[model samples]
Target: MLEDHRMSDISVAVLCREAGVSRTYYYHHFQSYADIIYQENIMSVVQYMRQLPDQGIITTTTMFTRYFELAAQSRDTQLTLVKVGLESSLIHSFESAFEYLVKNDLVVKAHPSRIGKKYWTEFLAGAVVNMAVRWLQTGMGETPAQMGRFVSNFVGLTE
Candidate 1:
């Protein structure tokens, strides 16, 4: 529905109808439409990352690459979020997803510096989210693999 209509045009009632769920269920689970989109996007990345084999920097690069790939595939949704002034939601999603990886020990060897794991994860999450926002805003001309390698190199994840 978002593809065909602007967010402002879609009401919660409409969404509930489209989703075939009761308003009670929707309200019980989600705060708003934006929350629904945010959770869906973040969960998609988390699920994808969870399925990947842990392979050090290789896994990091692949994960970052997949992030870009997903963004590109969801250009419409990305644009809509930006248009609705919800770009921060996208940023938060990336940051939260990265934190989840770090916290769950899914991503290894993240602390190359003397920095604590918490700080290192925070730094990387900020860097990744900023880079991702810029890439999406600027038409994402670079390929996902290229962006992935660039991030890995920039963050010293690669030797």
Candidate 2:
């Protein structure tokens, strides 16, 4: 199969030539390319999130560290997410993760002397999404352990 071949047209013919597998065998494995991508890419995100500790149970540093840890594990899917245009769901997932942090209080709530607590949550969540997108575009830049320190400093995560 040509590297430039459209995955949207990765039919039985393509798979057959690429893997030396018959059409029937391909069907035995995957219903369609999208089906495989859904089962593998999307579901893996949910699984990875499930594996993450609830924010209440861990330190703020651990929370952000685990964020990158999960992302590193799913780097391919993260890139596939950008390549395949999953923006809305990606935003939703980011918001959901942010909410988890807020509800679990892993991040510091903004005091009245500073920004509103809601703003802090939104800011931190958006910052996390930005970090994630950058990581997908390039790489995580630092170790997950180091990422934890960066996150702690960035979000003022001390309790």
lDDT top scorer:
1
TM-score winner: 1
Query: How far in Å is the alpha carbon of 85 misplaced in model 1?
Result: 1.3
Q: Residue-wise lDDT of candidate 2 within 26-130, one digit each (tens)?
A: 688887765555555446456645766664455667666777777788776666666666544455565566566556565555342433454665566567756
Q: List residue ranges in candidate 2 displaced over 4 A.
A: 1-56, 104-116
Q: Each prediction's TM-score against the native? A: 0.75, 0.56
Q: What would you estimate as the lDDT of candidate 2? A: 0.63
Candidate 1 clashes: the total is 0
**lDDT by residue for model 1 (1-159), tens:** 776777888988999999999999999999978789888878867765764666643367877888778778777777777667677777777777776765666665444452245566567766876687778889888998899889988987753
Residue 94 accuracy (lDDT) in model 2: 56
